[model samples]
Target: MLLIRNLIYWLLVAIVTPLFFLGLFIGAPLPRRTRHVIGESWARLLTWLLWHVVGLRYRVIGAENIVKEPAIICAKHQSGWETLALQEIFPSQVFVAKKELLWIPFFGWGLALTNPITINRSDRANANRLMLEQGTNRKQHGFWISVFPEGTRTRPGVAGKYKLGAARMAKQLDMPLVPVAHNAGEFWPRNAFLKHPGEITLVIGPAIYPRDDVGPEAMTRQAEAWIEARQREIGGVGPFAHPDERKARTA
Candidate 1:
């Protein structure tokens, strides 16, 4: 049943994607906000299809933690789920995604229309510079920046090394970082075709302000600590969990 549902959902994605891409050309002559709205509509539609077609639902905790001002979102990257979900959560936002994603066809074109901060991951120095430059510009224009601290998706119960790019941007721009933790990978495994029907919990932790005395490394550590701790509290298995800790948990 789950496999059939997943296939149907993917079929819907294949059918709807090009139609959504047309939004890019249709919205090109309009204002930036208009283009964003068109992009957001596509995201919202996809999210809706995930729930209705795939039977995968989500619940967000601590939504109030989302502040009014633009912020840098430091989130756990587990699967592609959060990418679509975050677009619905934040009003005006841009993701710091890989430049390679822009090469993909209709999807990449749609992403380009949204003006995300794309980086060539092969060049670390250039990528950092571009992140700082473009991230600052996007923030100034009132677009919240969503960055996955791990830089790539991690499997469920696995904790990837958190990078300092988002932290540096937060410190340099004096922006508050909103740490997000979720157990999405448990149901939607990374690059998996089939998704389990379950309620994925997404917890939004309070914004961590970068301290004047603290370096970006310290800030990254602080956010990582909060997110990891919260992930455990929300029943997410951590990669470093003790053998005893894993044994004691209820299934």
Candidate 2:
């Protein structure tokens, strides 16, 4: 049953994705924000199809916590589901995605139209510089920046290292950092062909504004603590700890 549903969903996706790509190109001459509207519409459509066709639904907790101003979002990376769903969850936003995504065929071209902060992960210094430079510009243009601090998807019940990039961007820009938590991995596990039918709970933590006295590492720890705690409550398996603490234990 799950396999059949997933097949149907992907078939529909194969039909819809390219059509949206055409829309993206047609809107390419428009302003970045306008192009983002078309892109987000594509994401929203896929999210709707996921619920109706794949039987995987999601509910957002603390929607009120989403701030009015353009802020930085530090979200857990668990599955591709969040990639689509975050477009619906937040306002006009740009993602901090890897530069490799730009090389993909249709999807990459559409993603480029959204004005994401693309970074080459191998060059840490360059990635940070690009993020700060482009992130400031995006925020000034009223686009929230969403960063998956883990850099890539992690399995359900597993905790990935929360990098300081997002926190650093937020601190440098004096913007708010919002941490997000969800159990999307349980239903839509990474690299899994079939998605399980279930309800995914996504929690949006209150905004953590940057302080002159605090550094990115501390802010990153705070975000990680809140996100991981919520993960355990929602459905994640146990023994979550910060990367530093885990290292300290071994040392």
lDDT of 2: 0.88
Model 2 spans with C-alpha error above 4 angstroms: 236-251
| RMSD to truth, every model | 2.7, 5.1
lDDT of each: 0.84, 0.88
Listed in order, each prediction's TM-score against the native is 0.92, 0.92
lDDT of 1 by residue, 1-251 (tens): 87899999999989887887887878887776778888888788888988998888899999999998899999998888899899998768999989999998877877887889999978987877888889888887889999999989886566799999899999988899999998888777778788777778899989988888999999899999999887776654433233443555644
Cα distance off (Å), candidate 1, residue 220: 0.4
Winning model by lDDT? 2
| lDDT tens per residue, model 2, 70-108 | 999899998899989999999888999889999998888
Model 1 clash pairs are: none
Pairs clashing within candidate 2: none
| Clash count list over all predictions | 0, 0
